[model samples]
Target: MKCVAQAGLYEARIPTGAPYKLRIGWADGWEEGADPYSFPPLLSHHDLHLFAEGKHRELAHMMGAQTMTIDGVAGVRFAVWAPNAKSVSVVGDFNLWNARRHPMRLRHDGGIWELFIPNVMSGSRYKYDITGPDGARLPLHADPFALASEIPPATASVVASPLDFEWHDEEWMARRSSFHAENAPLSIYECHVGSWRRPDKDGTRILTWDELKETLIPYVVDLGFTHIELMPIMAHPFDGSWGYQPLGLFAPMPRQGNPQQLASFIDACHQAGLGVILDWVPAHFPNDLHGMARFDGTCLFEHQDPREGLHPDWHTLIYNVGRNEVRGFLIASALMWLTQYHVDGLRVDAVASMLYRDYSRPHNGWLPNYYGGRENLESVEFLRELNHAVAEYAPTALMIAEESTAWPGVTRSVDSGGLGFTYKWNMGWMHDTLSYISRDPLWRRYHHDNILFGLHYAFSEKFVLPLSHDEVVHGKGSLLSRMPGEGGTRYAGLRAYLAFMWGHPGKKLLFMGAELAQWEEWDPHGELAWNMLDTPWGRGMHALVRDLNRLHRTEPTLHQRDTHSDGFAWIIGNDTENSVFAWLRYGDDGKPVLVVCNMTPVPRIDYRIGVPLPGWWAERLNTDADDYGGGGTGNAGGRSTEQIVSHGYEQSCVLYLPPLSVLYLQHEGGAG
Candidate 1:
């Protein structure tokens, strides 16, 4: 029991046995002076309400919810405010995987089930077994109030209460202000923790966050990615659903690690000079009863009606953002992660669903916004408020949207007729690129417009070129699979496409395995076929991606904020033949970079390519280089710029462009 005073505020500590009111300085800097001891309980409560009227929205939401207590034992002493359910048992790991052995006692006040299982240690797992009104046996259920973790069915998980890890990220944490101000180019490497690493043999061995920190951190840093956009780490009840069906918004999945372990992983990333952006799913949650569906005797946090509550395609329950308490709960949850875990950014998942009331639904099943559109007014308001609060509280943190619709002003400031996000995924680019690449090499000419068409929207809200987790999953296959040919040609084609991706106007993001040209669909159970790293093709692709990262960092033309009309220009060639496509990228200093790509499978003969300047241009990078598993059809190392010439048309030049290869030419400023 000690006391001290600082900045006109009195701080006092009391023994654990005493019942005392802990007072802190109010937001208005009010002091509890003089007769603080003589204040009556009722009068003090009234005064507290006066103090709370404008400043305690987050605390107010917490007050209406059921109270929970964690006994000193390693496990939690949970008692939901639910006044229903005929029977309930703490049925997780503490009960030896039996649902019936440890039934909870029904308290007198309501139908609340109470239980304290001492054996349910921290890092030990458990769930509830609730028997409903008509004798329906609900198996071990996810906890609505869980601040830690949940398990996927058919695969049991343990509860890891937080860990205490040593962190060395104080410097990164302090630089938050400058980090956001400069608008540094955000090159994100999006990854799914589960699928990113699993047992090589696959007998249900999961790689923990600790393992990822040790194994994946160095690889990512070596790859030169500035950030890692983690696919949802929030606790969920299904392995097949990815982390999108979130059951615990405030807690990292225990299946991966304890909260502290997850924090350590993030800290490790920061130490390696990488930002972490979490994929946050706020659109809907799983319908599992043990989750937020029907706790506290009703659909407390979700919409009551099916039309408003259900996401038909996802088969999940939508949150009622219209309710003040629910809105506060969600906003508070977002703030909690930012504050507690020090996450640098959040990629709001499925934002298109949240924006439209009729998203994936029939006309009669939807509501309209104030403008008489399918836009959900409440959701819009919630998002606006969320962004505003994020800016106010965590100004350094970036908010990105996985929004596909042309939801006007999504990345604009909320007060300036916009949604106030830092960036929005260039979903159009992803679709167009995939569609174009999936076709045969000969047919690429017909679809060539898709690539340029994507550039028209490149200026839309600070875009990020995302070949994200979505592309590899759901039967789309890996990037290598989407290429036109087989063997070394396919590998070369993939390298060409990746080079194009890196040199594009926007920020870049690739899934974990894409750097290595992972042949199979991504699996959540094991490490990226690490064994493939020894192969020549895999190593070549990996090296190319690493070099691309270096190129992005070293070249100012590839940065985000430098986009201008003159910064990029496409050089027209034989459009009908679709034989070649060329473009120039210029930095602010007028240093030009010429890029020419031939989509044809056969070697292009005497292909005349028009460059922007007549000066001698050196081939900086070529996909046809022997080092990248190409046909060695390009200039051998230093012989690239030997007497290259130009005609008119913006200082145009001609060259023999190679087939299925991309060439980068940098102006060397003299006839060789």
Candidate 2:
């Protein structure tokens, strides 16, 4: 044994042969373990090269704490990338949280530190003890690629066993592509697992993944929703952020359960015919001490300059996507959800923040891009690369973008100089429609453009008309409460608006609780207002939503041509004074379906509207039906189109337009 430069530290030079445990005795105690230095490096030179090139598709397998059997000796191999760190060590329960017990060796090629700790089993909590270049010990950081983490309020990464999940989603996996096709019905029910249903009134307890599988899965299916889009379930420190600010990109949030339980829940969703989509936030990360902020006492994962790095609105650190390692890390996080957990899709959140350098920044607070433009060029490239990788790895998985801006070609192909998202949230449409629907019907004529403006760009990009959680939070009140009238009128208006949204030219996404017409805004601290269903108004609204989803899925004309302008045409779009709108929706293989909406409370008797053909038009749905809390004012079944010329069409239909309601009529292929 020889004394090293550090005091009270010694190195032993022993001939290497078969593996054996080494023991050291101190004045008060003793410790035993196989020397970490004695083991060969776990990552090969090629692995380091790929990581350096930012082309490593499976970095999760090489980085973070992974349980393995190295040279017939079972242990956990820990690895982290901190190029600027002077030294790094593994600190955890096995070593009594001592940084001096197991210092890691740095591989200079890729700036990765690794070490194999003998006899370290899975489920052991750990963190990295890093010393910056200035010789100052930085805060312990949770593993960037950790597959499992300790429940919040406890910051540590857990050594996870290799995934041994026996998946039973073969049927769903084999045909999910069809489910995501543009022509297929896409009705997404956006949900928050924590708030969907809680066991206690205080919201102190959270349900496990298995519990959600039993509750949420069947609930969504019964509601007729095609998919359940969960708000961020990634590991984040703050509960209020709603998983927006994630620290553990790879780890499943321990709040719900372990990673394996999550996989089982996803499996259950697939078996029940419900697709799962996770809200993925890669734009910024919170500055929690145990997270990736100021890692290695430097802006390692984020931009060094505040002008480029800090997100003004959120006060979060924006990732430095220009760095190869950071880009690779983010992409791997996305792939982990798709390939590892078997989620159907990822809805990238706050894409507007990532696409613009001046997002939510004051004139003097932001820096211009390299070309003197406001766009974030590096982030743009990173997004394109991420989409390409997802396409290559998980070809059938959807990559939706929650971008709020009018950025061109967001859903276009990347090879064609576009961002290449599968679908974009139609924020403009949502804003306009909500503004129009919220106004008093007496003054709605003045703002009629709000209702008609969305169609001008309806087919600009593959869109999803999202009535998301953003609309019902922070004192905005629930969707039901946003109407401009009292009592039954409010219920009628909400039903009309929902029907309008479902019939509009795009996919559909509604936040949880909207179906029941809850009056209170979303309370993240409590479960949804499910008790409201006991009320007549709530039950009526719930029934309407279920019927709407059923019709949207079964009627080809309602969903098949959602993305093509050729499938939609206006029959009476210029009737602002009457506050009435009419349109025709067509599918390749089905007869056209006519839709008419009356925003005012005054019913229009014998209202004339153009029709494409003379036929017995069967009424498919009426928002004014008594079952949906309306006055039951509607035509008997349906009306036959007369050969009277109107709105430049040879045929016309004289109909009883219900107050604050919308009607859907399908052509039955016979002239009256």
Candidate 3:
């Protein structure tokens, strides 16, 4: 054997040309592995070109540790983008965490360092040890595209084979486009799996995906909700972030079992006739040492300038969306969940923060865009590109935005110079309606505009009226506790408010504990008060929510024209003195459903409201029903409209309106 020396390492020359493994014996034990340098780079020139151009929609599959067979040998291909690193190495349990054992080969075209380490199979934990451009050793970096990760507190990336779970929701996937159509019913149950229920008394035991499959899926299905919107489930280091500040963009949270279990949970949801929407954060990320904050000892994922890079509120680093590679990275992450996990939709979080450069910043604390405008032009382009990619790649999936500002054309098509989201959270509607409902009936009259103001611009964008977890957290009180009334009156107010929301022209979303009228505000660290369901008010509130979901799904007039201007018309919108509101909703078939609400405690006998059809109107639902803990004061069955012109209608109906109640009346048939 001949030995040659280079860089303080002695390499023994072998006469054989074929690849071979080496076994090194130590004082106590021996380790054996094939040299990673024996293999060629896995990434191609075209992939790098596409990524550099911000068009690599499948980058997640290429950039991470992917299992493969090269030259008749099975192994895992590890690739990472660290352009400024002086040297990079794959270090893990396979090599006894030795960085010197496998130095990666960097392809200068895209600054991508790659190596195929044979015998490194799935379940092997690993990370990248890098020497910075300044020749200083940097902290080990977790893979940004890791498909699975070590549970938090153990900062290592786990090697995982691609998700290969067998799906049993063929029927659901086939017709998912129809389920997400604007005309279809979309009542979502916003849930935080950790706090929804606890198997233990301390509420510290978070439910795994398999646990949720057996519990959350059936519960949502039984409640008649069309979808379940899970709070962010991406891999994050902090439980307090609720998966918002995700580090592993492509990995499922290991706390919820593996990627396969999460996929199975989603499959179960689909089979149970429920769509799943995930909250995805793309605006900013925490500056954790192992995260993408200063990869390669540079601000690779975020802007270097603090004025443009830092998030004022969360103290996180704002993404450099203007960068081509960053845009591709984020879009690839969005696609991974939709395609690999079979997720139905992504609700982009902190969209308002991304939309404006000066969001939550003082005038001097922010940097203006190229045009000196507050609008983040680069972010706008990225969103449009992201939505366009989702539409092209996963046509059945939806891209929703949690945008609070009055951003025009948020849900409009990209071809028309819009952001091209399928839906936007109607934050204004949630705020104003909650405000109106929280007031005393006597004072509500003076704040009548709060309830009616939403309709003024209801059709501006496709909206999802969300009573999400935000309303019940941060000392704001539970939805039930926010009502300003005595015991029964509070329940009545909540019921009436829910009915009004359902009857309103938008899709619906309710948080987990709102159905049970849980007294405590949302606590991420604690579970919901499930014992509350044993009480009378709790049972009634739950029943009412179930029935409301049923009505929203079964009735065409209620959901068929949610985004159309013609779907809604007012009958007595200006009757603020009596604290009453009346309106009509119409479906595509022209069938009408009249809604009347009494916000005060005094019942109104013979309350007159106009109807378009002179026919027998059946009372479809009453918020004052005894089943929902109400006084049961309502029209005996229904009222027939008389041929008396009122409120510019050819027919009018007079009925007994219950105190603090909402009534739904549908035209049955025949002229009165």
**Which segments of model 1 are wrong by more than 4 Å?**
1-145, 154-166, 176-183, 560-566, 636-650
lDDT of 3 by residue, 1-672 (tens): 223655556577666687687777778998777766777677899998988887898977899899999888899999998999999999998888999988899889898899999988899999999999999999999999898899988989999998899999999999999999989999999999888888765565878889889988989999999999999999999988988899988988888798889989999999999999999999999999998988999889999998889998999999998999999999999999999888999999999999999999999998898988999999999999999999998998988899999989999999999999999999999999999899888899899999899999899999999999999988999998998889888888888888899999999999999898788899888888888789888888899999999999999999999999999999988998899999999997777899999999889988888788888999999999989988877888898989888899988899999998999999998878
1 or 3, greater by lDDT = 3
> Which residue pairs collide in model 1, if any?
92-126, 92-127, 93-126, 123-159, 195-524, 197-526, 198-525, 198-526, 198-527, 611-653
Candidate 2 lDDT, 391-432, residue by residue in tens: 999999999999999999999999998998999999999999
Give Cα-based local distance difference scores for all models. Answer: 0.70, 0.92, 0.91
Query: Stretches of candidate 2 above 4 Å error?
Result: 1-6, 16-19, 26-31, 200-202
lDDT of 2: 0.92
Query: Candidate 3, overall lDDT?
Result: 0.91
Best by lDDT: 2
**Candidate 1 to truth, TM:** 0.80
Candidate 1 backbone overlaps, count: 10
RMSD of 2: 1.4
